[model samples]
Target: MLRFAGFELDQRRIELRAPGGEPIRLRPKSFDMLRLFAANAGRVVSKQELMEAIWPNIHVGEDSLFQCIREIRTALGDEGRQLIKVVSGRGYLFDAEVSGDPASFAASAGLSSASEQEGLAQQAGGHAAATVAGPAKKRQFSFGLRSRVAAVIAVLCAVIGFAVAAPMFAPGVVAPENTPTITVMPFVDGGSDPQATSMATNVTDRLADGLAKIDTIRVVTPRSDVTTASLANAPTRPADTDFVVSGELQRSANSWTLEARMTNAATGEVKWTTSVAVDTENTDLALQQSRLAAGVGHELAVRINAVLYPRAGVASPLTGSTKVVVEQALASINQTTRERFTAAQTMLESALANAPDNLDLQVTLSALQTRGIQMNWYSAAESTAAESAARSRLERALQAKPNYLPGLEAYCRFLTATNNFVESLVACAKVLSLDPWNGSALYQLGLTQIQLGRFDDALANFKQADRFDTPAVSRWTWLLGIGWANLLLGHSEEAVPWLQKSIAITPASGRPYMVLAVALQGSGRTDEAKAALAKAMVLRPGSTALNVAPPKRNASPVFLEAGQRFIRTLVELGLPAG
Candidate 1:
């Protein structure tokens, strides 16, 4: 019997007992997990090691392991994870002290080996007579026809069970087919100034070399310069060129400007273009070249990626001035008022009117519309219209810019809200590929993972969003996301503080209150839970367990049932049935 934290784990019987000697039931996996923890008490167990130990040779989602851990915590009444601590970005540790006497404990629980049993029997002065009779009894036993027939039937059933549930165990998304190819033409010196020539060559070389690092694209540098003459006019298609990148260098006194453009090699249509200006008088020439090349290369890679991966990878065709307008409009997204939302909407609409083909404006407008739908800032009819409009605009934006990070992140959030988990995961992943530290994309990734019952993974992603410190991390939804994941994982103590933080950030919203109610309820603070629910009802009048859907989730049966239970708790606390 291994003892720790007011409970004893009887390894032989595979049971845990409370201090009062009452048995605490645990599922087989939960018991095994507890056993592992007891064995390695005070040691951090990596997720990989835990998974392999508990489920050798079985292909299971990370969520399954998370579920087992949750169950073990519940059985131990370790809601705060004080005894079983989670080490962020690492694994878990059994922090409690555990000790036990092996042989006597095993013998008491009927787990002693034959030799040990014999030794115990001999010590008790009653073993040989019982053992001698046991062998004679075994000799007299025989397998009858009924027993043989039953064994055969059991074997057949096992075979049938294996054949039934194979497809559900399959792997995830397939990778892209082929790598995209891009040709970087030498930069043209558009000025008579002698400094411009060397600067142009350096910029072109640095840009091409930097862009070549993106594994998704094949960056090609031609053996000979593709002249500025061809770039100025419509250039002929180069062999095997999917896209063509060319730029011109201009110098005026101490300042230099590089104007770069990428085009469709076949149609000679401009796909992307940007200009960077730097003062060579203040900065070293090498530093100026490196910084300029890095900027140009980053933009070029985004454009190429969008074309290569059509689902995501579109750059917004907006100048810095135009981008500032969109950023200002996006600021009102989390304010939770129709007036604020509409003001942002009007700003985007005006910008779109001026530049109808601008992908950045379209993307911003679409995202604003989707946010309205999510926040219920629009009337029913208006929401329906907005959803349709947003989808259409986002589609057009994707076509125009293909891998626009903001556009993809917004689409991913929209997809998750609309119950499209698979597509959302893909889109969110694309956003991460372009900018790994994008908090919005990380948040979207967490939301999709939540719907799939991968709360542990979701929580990890949410923490990553915080670490990235993206603007989205400041949004109330970030804290709410972490809170909800903990609530779903049965970590109510942990959930309460996160939900409380969310409420502090955005008290006007109903979601934090609703989730806070559940966390409070789970923690046995019934009166506080009731107050939270009342606040939720006040914020969203006439809202109910039935009408207020749970975050577009279609998870495992256990999670679905747990969701129902949570709702039932809310209803019992006087939430409306409607």
Candidate 2:
């Protein structure tokens, strides 16, 4: 029996039980999945690996896998989604600690072995009380015979129990290989300033600390001066590490840039390189340092994880026009305009026609479609078709390459766009679990929290995202989320600045303007509210107060009511009611 979180998994009985011993019902597939997770606790189990194991040679879709995951989570009361965590693109990780009872009752009680049973029989001949199965009148058997019978019965029971419980030894489970060790070399200071040298040292330590947070990679500090060039030339790493990270911190006129690269220790190949800068002018000194460390650390972590858990890829990578088309398509997604969205969609569709199996193209198109869904760019039927296509494509891509980060991000966005807030909670959390500094995933998490009416939690998430400010392209999203959440909590005055900040970053998105109007109206600024409403109307024409509010389907009652209030306020500001 395996035990975790006060629950028992009975291998012999093929059952799961609560702490009080009530049997928890699980579908056969779910039971198998749970058993697999229990056996490989703390390890990521890929989706393909799982389907192959659970269904064997039978073909299946990802829905079946998700259903099993859902059922397992429900059975384990894993509402927090911590027990069985989705590791973003890597796979599913059973994060819970597990233990098992390997010593059977016979061994613990000292009565199972043949010699022990013989000794028991001999002892029973003199003093052991024994019983025999017989009629009461014929029950007066010799103690030696009764004891011998008892010993035989005990031996038989032990053998039967051992045979029945043998499966708990976990036949298919195997230990994972050791984690890849990463050594963080000291940072080079580019400027002559004494402060720059101190900052570089601090950044080095901070980067190491951040990388250490990732459980998949082991971070080691270099004892002596180390450089990527030196490590590359050496036959062996000083600590026998797998990878080395070397970086230089430079103080610029307006910003501090940290350039870093990771090289394979044995091959001397530079696996990844990045340069990230933090604004020293606008941000506080400490905040700049924090962002500098997080900026580079987040990127390095992604690259390292990609190398460690590479997804299934095509024989040839996207190059030339295909690569440009893909990049352009993704850039257009950031524009947040209806025409740009449609054009980008067309571009991706055409490119995908040539390489239908390209995972990058598939995920990009799905993400663009998901963005359209979020922006209400589709009619009801088109929206349905888009959602279905996005989900199917993403599922297929993820099943093919379960640990791909882009696919995971797109999936989380799809879930949030469809208002699958409950599942979005899990998906977004998984993204953040692997990439803790991801602002986009954090925005999704906060939005889901808002719909669930957890206003304070939503605000906290948005603020946390703001603190990280990663992928600064997604900054406007969390800013808008913060403003919307504050408005939802009736802090209209406090919501105004964040909404304005969002508009300053991406003024084309009418939604932020709509939110600004709401905040202005709530603050009793009628003229300002009308002005904001007019700007929203210009950016998002033909939006009726009735349909301008978010889709009410599947939303919590409190959120739906608040949404209606937002719509009514828009109506008051001359928004069309049709």
- Put down candidate 1 lDDT per residue, 334-364, tens digits, no spaces: 6556667788898889888888877778878
**What do the candidate models score in CA lDDT, each in turn?**
0.64, 0.71
Off by over 4 Å in 1: 1-325, 379-381, 471-475, 551-559
**Which ten-residue region of model 2 has the weakest summed lDDT?**
136-145
C-alpha TM-scores of all predictions: 0.48, 0.66
lDDT tens digits by residue: candidate 2, 223-313: 4445566776665456568898988888878999988888888888888999998888767765676678778877886887678655435
Q: Which has the greatest lDDT? A: 2
Residue pairs with backbone atoms closer than 3 Å in model 2 (clashes): 89-403, 90-403
